[model samples]
Target: MTQPPATPLPPPRERRRLRESKSLSQAQVAERVGVTRETVRSWEAGRSTPKGRKRTAYATFLASVEAEHAPAGTVAPPSLNSRSAGRHGSAPLTRSVEFVQPPVRTAEPVNCPHPTRPPKTAAEAFDRLYTHTAPALVRQTYLLTGRRTLARESVERAFQLAWQRWPEVAVDRDPAGWVRAAAHEYAMSPWHRLRPSHRRPEAPPADAADRALLDVLLSLPPAYRRTLLLYDGIGLGLPETAAETEATTPAAANRLLHAREAVAEKLPVLAKPERLHERLAELAGAEKLQAPKSTLVRTDGERRTRFWTRSAIAFTVLIIGTTALTLRTAPTRYEPVPAPGAVISGVPPQMGPGPLSQADKKLRATLRGSGRGGPHRLAPEAG
Candidate 1:
């Protein structure tokens, strides 16, 4: 028999939203669907589609989930075929299936005042994002680091970075998330410990319970603390928390578990995750963690970019100048020079004529005595 037509799956993003709404992790979904977690990820990311039996299984799972979460009186359209019904023991699938669309609210004007128009310029877009997200992000950073100044600084810096890369940030799926990750990284940087200002701890919350919760949170490792904040404090799904924390799903789960246990051990009242989340929100809200103005952030980012750019140019020019000067002053040709003469030692001095030899002295005396003409006469008589 011919295989049943492929199941009509929801859009990739919708599939992920459905899973997360059901509080199901990729690993959990993968297990139930008899596939690897990577396979499920690929399917959700639209990198690949499930085929044959897996396709039907995945579609069935998503449809059932959607149906369960659908509003009252709404139903998910059936996409299963007769072959699928026979295998699952459901009613025989019909060829024609109609999808049910939710009722649209038309009472409100199409141009509502609340939803602002899209930003026309990059600066406007960046400012809009900063204004919308900075306040909460500052508070979140405060919870992450427990330093008010650092919290505001982190948010400001993260926005500056975002402004610097506006093209990337504007097109990002979650600009707030991009900035949040940057802020979290800056707040938790190991280098911050070296600063004299950060060397001392910030004051604890005034309320006893708030103080206690903050202490418990700060006592945990930074990784564990961040995981708890993202998962419990921010209500992010496990995959999202893991992705934010740069960890695997299992690793994020482990961190969350350990963090929760630590918090609960210290503060029994916050044993429940929900209670912990509430306490965290309360503590963060109580702080005076205000972010800088969006205009200031944008200006600072531009100023910082200019400063670095000019500094780089100046440094390059200095290097070029120094190299040119060296080349100009350097010797062009080789010149050889004789070494200075040194005194020779260790030779016997010449004896002053060593007293003229005795024979030479006698001949000199005889010549002097016979120098007269008598010597010449005596020589002639002998000839």
Candidate 2:
């Protein structure tokens, strides 16, 4: 009978045959390859693939099989150590290789999104989101740190950063959450920490009395202050707070409650916002001062709206002015002229919406666990 024609071997099969020919088991080949026997078995069955550095690794294993089988007279003389060393990136064939195979590893790294997050010029990102977020970030920070100047500076720096990577960050699951996180990071920066004047902030609003309270709150560790603000000011739930602050839900809740108790015990003045401001102011006056010029976010909404509105209007006028000049100087009068100022006067229109719509507000409020029976009350003794 005619011998069956020889078929060229696949990579895995070739590797496996090399082992079998050397009288080595799957486990032995796996040991040479620095992998488990199951991996070798999978390779033999063609149930898996090995690529990249691992491909070189497998080739090295086959080379080792050839060397081991040398005593058995199966390996061809010329096709021995020389070829394997070159393929395995080891020393020249004159020297022996001490093979160290890698163990089977599937999860090697965290899947970072940075590579694919769109490349954004930081300035472009800031220009897109700064106006929308800077004010709230500033206000929230001021409330927490009691340092209006530092808060103002902190928000600007944070938003500046956000702007730098706007495309990448805005596409994240929660852009606002990113803003909050950025603000926190900014608050902890050396620039913010070094400026001592910002520690005792101007009292919130009209309260001269809240200064004392503010001082006490500001004196707490940063974690406590952040926990307090996210809980008391942002009204975040425990789990939501955990996601924001990088804590477990129970930990976040306990932190909030603990911080609240600490603040109350340390400075009872916060029970009344007015008194809190006054006390902080007194503390500031009594403390030997470090006078860094601070930026304050003292303006209320209408002022901010006017400031941005004026800016937008001024920008429009400049654009129109430039366009008009371009049209006059152009080789053709047919170049499209801009419409009158009235058209774009309504541009960006107004602040329009707040954090969410009323419907969304209700839904979020509903999700807040109903505050049912006020957290302390049990369910009517289960009837």
Instruction: Put down candidate 2 lDDT per residue, 48-81, tens digits, no spaces.
Output: 7766555568866666655664443221211111
Supply the global lDDT for candidate 1: 0.71
lDDT for each residue of candidate 1 in 1-383, tens digit (9 for 90 to 100): 89667889987756765674454556779999999977886776677999998998999999898776444322211111111111112112111111111121111121223333555678766765665466667777888888899999988999999999989988776777788889999999999888999878778889988888888888999999998887676655666667889998778878988998999898999887656766776786687666677788889999999999999999999999999999999989987788997657887655666676899999998888888644445345554
Overall lDDT per candidate, in order of appearance: 0.71, 0.51
Best-matching candidate per lDDT? 1
Clash number by candidate, in order? 0, 23
Model 2 lDDT, residue 361, Cα = 84
The candidate that achieves the highest TM-score relative to the unseen native structure: 1
lDDT of 2: 0.51
How many residue pairs clash in model 1? 0
Q: Name the lDDT value of residue 19 in candidate 2.
A: 56
